[model samples]
Target chain A: MTVNAIQTRRTDPYSPPAEHLELQGDEPVAFLDWRDGRKAWAITKHADVRTMLSDVRFSSDRSYPDHPAHGGYVPGAHKGAIIAIDPPEHSAIRSRVMNEFTVKKISLMRPRIEEIVAEALDAMLDGKSEAELVKELSLPVPAMAIAELLGVPYEDHEFFEHNTAIFADSSHTDPSQRVEAIGKLRDYISKLVDARMDARGNDILSRQLDAGLDAEEAVGLGFLLLIAGHETTANMISLSIMTLLDKPDLLQQLRDDPSLIPGAVEELLRYFTIAEVGGLRLATTDLEIGGKRIHAGDAVYGLTNTANRDPEVFPDPHTIDFKRGARNHMAFGFGPHQCLGQNLARLELVVVLEQVIQRVPTLRLLDPISAIAFKEWGPNYGISELRVAW
Target chain B: MSAHIVAKRETCIGAGQCVFADPDAFDQDDDGWVVVLQADPASPDAIARAKEAVNVCPSRSISVLTRPEPGAGTGEAG
Candidate 1:
């Protein structure tokens, strides 16, 4: 394997490095990732990434000391979480909670999600011409939504939000700090799980309890959902807003045709495939992908961001095209472990974007795009604070 | 019109695009994999909806085969 053949770099947190984009083609490139200080294959082509994601031989268990991870944190304690497990067990655990995320199920929550977005918008735009959209609108919307969905009291969102931020932020180099944060979040969720066991409610935690999951397992599921439910969609919202404002014509197009919101959301997801470093998998057995032979125990990073921009699948992949049909993008990953909360995320994005565009007509960035502070060290790429004026 | 439905179970990620598109023809199993509800759907609307489901499947797991028209067929039906 040639280490110099590919070197992954993120000069801009929002966009994949030019070197990564240039390596996209029918072949998988081998790269030496700085984070793990390990040599791994970077799968950049769209089809190759999809195929690898579905192949059961490629495992998602990050407990393996050699597991390819952005930061030194392996999150090994999160093994019970759906994202950290393989099939059979993964299927069993995920199936119990799958019904909650179905299109029909999430659609039922649309009115509630809209209400949350509206409330956040009202609070943000109450008496001020300018506000940090990330703090005011993006974060709280999904945070409250997930809190309500999990039957956790929304008043405690600040606790989980702060802890989740530390856990998800890649820049927080202290592994012990992340572990402590996870421990606190897990303990908090365990308490909620215990409370639900005594008095069940209609929320997701109560439902998991009904499914006969043990307290620890239930708490694991709750932790996974709580962190994933809010952090990902929140980042997507902030990034989408940033991308939308940067391109005023696209914003105007969305403003004129609200029907185009769904399509626009899909396009934005493809344009900004924010799952930093894609989904990392360990090759359990020898495999061949994109004509390149992968050895057993090799760490293969599915470069979803680059795959979304593969010229072979998407024409002029770097350019944002709202008219383009990009629903096939790997922004959500693929295969059995494809994002379980995708339907809910899509619903949240549509509602939030529609409300912001329609209600906040005068919304514009307070600073230049480059001036915005982006969370470069997070597993997900998004702005830390988006100051906007109306 | 009659339609035959098939789901490539291995590729299905349980996105529920098929069930969402045509609940009559497709449903998810306990493990959330796609399960064909009606292999030989009788209604043209059902067949059309099944095709729509096949199109929307993120994993492209669902496939529909419609019986050939009576007079236009050369060999076998279904």
Candidate 2:
């Protein structure tokens, strides 16, 4: 039995680490060895990955030692962090706030989201022909959106976005800096939750409070949203733009037909599958996956990045096709813990692409894709900086 | 025969793919459970969207069933 070491380095910018993709073909459910001496199962096939994720037998509870999903942070200890819990508890907390992100609710946010995108673009394109797209556009759009969603005051936006960028983009900062940012953001959210308790508002935090969530739970929920909402979306925003600018033909496809932008966004998500480790689980009971019998008490990883490229599910999986309508991809993940803000993310991407393509006729990448710094070590895969000019 | 959409709310994880697929046919209740707004799709576009909803639903909570149209299936039809 051969155990392949988890490969984090990507030989190609548009694909997962080569070893993982190789494993997807040679051994779809391969044994894995982690750098920290953790032995686990890595499932890379699309069907198997979905089965592993949707089954409650594969526990998501991260309280146990050697849970592979932690990535050095133990969010399982945090109250109301639904992503770290399972079953009734996870559903209980998720239900409390899920309504805030419903398709109807998020769709209602389109006008405001468009305004936010326009504002970010306005700032980025104002009095300038070139700017680093990450700092100028990608970072701020999602940051401001999350801030408004949480009712973070206009005055605190700078502090909130700054700390979140440092904390979320772990590849760019030292552990201590990331820790400091988390601490600062936690304290800010705690204080804000306290303020909300005294006087409520129409925001997610206040709504959670109204739904009988105590201060700790409210703070935990708010903090999670503040971090999760912006960082992943911000990364997606930049990566999608960078991919577009890198491939002029693809970019021209969207430019030629604005209607293609939405489909292109889904294809980009499938192509990138940013979350390197998709659904990490601990087997609660013996189960068979991909014709391999696994006993209880084993750690498992559903390597979704590679799963997205599984040739069986996606024909010519390596090729990027905008019309593929790859909605079934596990990019936002699957099952109970699937991304709650997926609708919002899609809306933001569509609006951003529409505005960027329509407004910035000369937008071009200032650096080659290979020259760009990819966040290889981080929990999410994305570009650290995208320099672009109009 | 017509295609009818049924969503099992208990099994839904509120992924919202149903609504994404066919907003006219599905929605999320206030607590974010799946709500079927239209049980029988009227248009080909709507039926196609209903099928897409079934395809993308992560929980397998949605099913599209085909049954005879109301009066046409009855022997006493006018």
Candidate 3:
């Protein structure tokens, strides 16, 4: 494998790490040789990534600006929810909204998630073309699901989608540009939180008020949920359709047994693992992991993208199998920091894909597989455009 | 050997209960997303730690997993 300046100076819009651990034993893992000058160790193995994430020795402070995913951001302008910190600090902020992420909390919203998916799919199939599926089906499902969860009206989705795109797409732009994008999202969220407070209802925002977060923290966490909560799933919906269309057998299988869509979605998540890197974590102190020493204050990205592809855990690592034995992959991370929006994502994908196949039986890619566009990184791995014909 | 911990990411909901229950073993990322340190849940001590993290999580977005491997030992072990 080549490790040259071109790899390091990645400028293909956005890029997920392309490095892979050559599998030998039943368990093979490696660490990326990260850039120096405030750089931290990047743990890529399923084992190490899982360890580093839960290890209290690692911190998630934005002040460090350490993890590779945050590789190019400017400092001082960064402030966010506890998803960026280790507790007792992380706990102080997250405790305020813990109940909102539960199965029970989101169960009520499943009907709404279904409604949005139905609406998007109906429009998508009604007038077929080589449209950008990402903008059509992928973007809307999550945006609408999140909009409902936060009790934002469907009319407000354009604003929320814009704010989330700017916030989550930080990995793609220059440091200054990223700073501006984050500022815009924060400001937008702040206004939304205030409007909700004045018009308090039984939504998550109103509930968060009872927990004592002022306008800023409440908005920060709210913005976090809106973006991280659905963006990943949106990509999965678009990309997994591409994945299945490529494997018509799997798609047909899923079409036949709708129950399998949920498990199939899990399998797809394990196989594709859209997010290339776990969000960045800072080593709180010196540590030896996977036989490599990681010094304190260094940044590291738990490369979940790599971990999900580890051959030892997954046979023929690159293949997408519907019945793989070790299907549990790091697509959602692990430990205390595991993904909160996971079920919501899973629920959305299962329902969307199921209906997409049911509605459009001949949903084959119109363009050559090579013509399908994929975002290189940015917690999104999906086609910018997909032309489907039934 | 690397230290290990077990988590059901599908069940997790950024509750931060695991963050407080066992500060050494769990945390959230920038958007209140859970980042698991370990997921094997092999050792008894590790299993206990995971159980604590799972139990305290207000969202109950966690589960205890015990490794079937014969060599598995206790306390944050791989």
Candidate 4:
């Protein structure tokens, strides 16, 4: 391992941390020493990040105590949490629910998603000149969508969203509170899953139960979906809208040609590659990535944020080009572990952007970008809150 | 010779990047596996779409291969 240590903090809101960019430019793979006296390898270049993630030798199991993501790890807490497990268990579990999130299935939900977004906009703009966008629109859209998808009552969105925000936001310094929030969520989902065992519905949870998953497995899957489905997409929605508001030209471009909105969403996703921790993996075997030899049990991190900005892959990478239409970026990560809810998330983003731009033509930021608070310390990158008015 | 797209179902993880890239040329089955809708693109525009799908496919299951057509040229099909 080389003597290059790295930190995950991003100094600039729009870019990955300087340490990441420096390493990407200078080292394909470098030594990363976690603050807890643990060591790992950081793969930053686009090709190398893809090469590492695509290789199954890099395990995603987070149960290992030394795993970077194992800080607050609890064994079997979410029994079917696919992100923290390796195949064939991961493959078996993921395959069971894959069809639910397939392109066709998500497309079928488009009309419903449009309705959700429109309803959110209507509420945000109803007798209100100004509001907190995250509370009013960004959070509720995905929260309500996922709640409805999981057959959890959307009326409980405040409770669901509140606990999830506390649980998902790494900026929350209270570990005990985070655990408590998640536990409440888990119990709530457990009851939902238990009830479904008696009578099923046309939802993901009931379908999982019908597909032969036990109470615990069904509850786990539901819990994972609730957490995974909403918070990340909510963050993305807020961050994307914030960026568009900050750059009026880009906003006007999208207004002129709504066709460019999808591409703009892709570019924004790539540009703000949230989920900086998406690529943490433990090497299960000896491997060579970017010419660096990583032995078994070694921790490896694929800096997806840095990889998305690789000049070779994306010309003038820092500059957001709405016309890029590069779907090949690692914003959703790469390989079999790529985001399962991606299709649904993409559809949500497109729907929200289309409605916001069309419905609120006079929408403008109440505060400048400098005044906005960002979720810098979280597992996902996004704006904490943005004051906006139409 | 003509260029055409092919997909190996066994290798497909059904990430759906192909479907996102070119809906006209790709779709997924009930099992969430890639189903190639266009084996041979007829025009330059369609070929470009096929190439885009191939490029974005995470599993690298889709590819374009140039080969001889049985009746089109002085060459034999494989």
Candidate achieving higher lDDT, 1 or 3: 1
lDDT of 4 by residue, B1-78 (tens): 566788987667678888888888899999798898878887768778888887787767888775666667664222
lDDT by residue (tens digit), candidate 2, B2-58: 787888977787878988788899988877899999998877688889888987898
Model 4, residue A199: what's the lDDT?
90
Q: Rate the local accuracy (lDDT) of all candidates.
A: 0.77, 0.83, 0.63, 0.83
The TM-scores that each candidate's chain B achieves against the reference are 0.84, 0.82, 0.61, 0.79
Per-residue C-alpha lDDT of model 3 across residues A1-390, encoded as one tens digit per residue: 233211322122122345444321322333334455333344556666666776767776655655444433322232446556666666565545666764445556778778888998887767564455766788788877877777777687777676555544444446676568667766766787889778887777887786677777677676777557656777788778887887788887887788777678877887666655444676778888787787876666666666766666667777666666343466776655667677678778878887788877766777777666566544455545566666
Note the clash tally of each candidate: 2, 0, 19, 0
lDDT of 4 by residue, A90-208 (tens): 87888888888888888999999999899888888889899999877888888778887888776887797777667655553398888788789888888888788889988988888
TM-score, every prediction: 0.87, 0.93, 0.75, 0.92
Candidate 3 chain A: 10-residue stretch with minimal lDDT = A4-13
| Least accurate 10 contiguous residues by lDDT in model 2 chain A | A68-77
lDDT for A138 (candidate 3): 83
* Better structure of 1 and 4 per DockQ: 4
Measured with C-alpha atoms, the lDDT of residue A272 in candidate 2 is 90
Q: For each candidate, report its DockQ versus the true two-chain complex.
A: 0.33, 0.54, 0.11, 0.57
Off by over 4 Å in 2: A1-5, A35-37, A74-76, B1-3, B41-48, B66-78
Model 4 chain A: worst 10 consecutive residues (lDDT sum): A1-10
Off by over 4 Å in 4: A1-6, A72-76, A154-158, A165-178, B42-45, B68-78
Better of 1 and 4 by TM-score: 4
Best by TM-score: 2
